[model samples]
Target: MAVSCVRADPRLVEFNDIKIGHVYKKTVTLFQFTAASPAMVVVPGLLIPEKQEEVRDCLLIHVEDTETIKIPLLEFPKVCSLLVDSVLDFGCIAANNQVISKHHPITNKGTAPGAFQVQYSRDPLVTVSPCVESLQLAPPSG
Candidate 1:
């Protein structure tokens, strides 16, 4: 007797090719349904026509120079669940001594007031990276 081995056809992977830079313009609804301990079902997911669903941890967004991206929230409950990761961008610090020095322009004797401004600033645009991390429920930490 010989042991038999079979693998699913590789061509099946091409069913849907969702990639970076693909923007989902439609609203996606997520829900959970439970079955008794008598059973459990894990749905890998489905392929549909309108949009491809992706589960993400970190999110990326792209917008044209003129348009604004908006996500709507109806109430506090929604906000409580949303997780945000914040990164500090370039900002000005008072430690820098250089500042607008001169108050008067005509005297031209002492350092001119408000002549130089001491601060760091930049146009901070956040590049969204696909977040592979998802939140999980676990026992409470003591």
Candidate 2:
């Protein structure tokens, strides 16, 4: 006798279906750089729990790389908490596979730049063009 099994790929899993406040582990990198050159590897042994607490480490690095260096990343359900300048309502969008475009701006009201990722949307019809964005603002000149 022969038997076969099928398993769903975790990589293909839709994280949006997860309930709020679910704890999960994700690997992140932190870099130590100089004004002259970039480093080969980021600082290691830095671990933090995915809770709603501010992790203050470096201000300069944050200003340089907003897509990185943020503490306690607001991924998963927390991503939904992102504050948009205004709500987007695409009522009765074109059908028959016709694409429509809407432009919006995201603000970073911090001393450092940050990253925002559009993992998934509640509406199947809604999608982001450049799924990920870096929220970088100019650093204070000394």
Candidate 3:
């Protein structure tokens, strides 16, 4: 989604140069996640579980080439836990998705730039949305 800097919070920054709509000269894909499919792919070995969920049903954009690809994430609830378990418990399985988690600097432990440690903060951003704090979706285990 093309976002602008006009968002009330500066921390949630946006690109000023890019416009807020599909920018395709000839073959621009206006993907609408109007429906969910059962045969979606999960990428845990490639990325974090939480990160994988964010890209579900989201459209991807190649800034330079304008080559867009629709990323359809795991739709099944069972698949969600399994994919999440792989990443959160073991590792991630990224394929071609360009987005990533945070970037860990050279001094940090992770080998890659996006495998940074989770930084927590009690700042106003956390309080931006109420449901963000209230809803906790965890499966109960025996």
Please tell me which predicted candidate would have the highest TM-score against the true structure. 2
lDDT of 1 by residue, 1-142 (tens): 4332222112122222343344223232222222311222222223333332333221122223433223231111111122233443335445354532222211112211212222333423322222223333322448
lDDT of 3 by residue, 1-142 (tens): 5421111111111211222232312122232332432232322212223321223343243322544444332221111111112232214636374534432222322211222223446654322212222222233446
Residue 17, candidate 2: C-alpha displacement in angstroms:
36
Give the clashing residue pairs of candidate 2, or none.
66-113
The count of backbone overlaps in candidate 1 is 12
lDDT of 3: 0.27
Q: Candidate 1, which ten residues in sequence have the lowest lDDT sum?
A: 73-82
Q: Best candidate per lDDT, number?
A: 2
Task: Name the regions of candidate 3 deviating beyond 4 angstroms.
Answer: 1-47, 50-55, 59-63, 79-142
Model 1 residue 129 lDDT score: 26
Better of 2 and 3 by lDDT: 2
Q: Which ten residues in a row have the lowest lDDT in candidate 2?
A: 5-14
- Tens-digit lDDT string for candidate 2 (3-87): 3222211212122222335544433333334444433333332333455443333222233333333243232232222347576
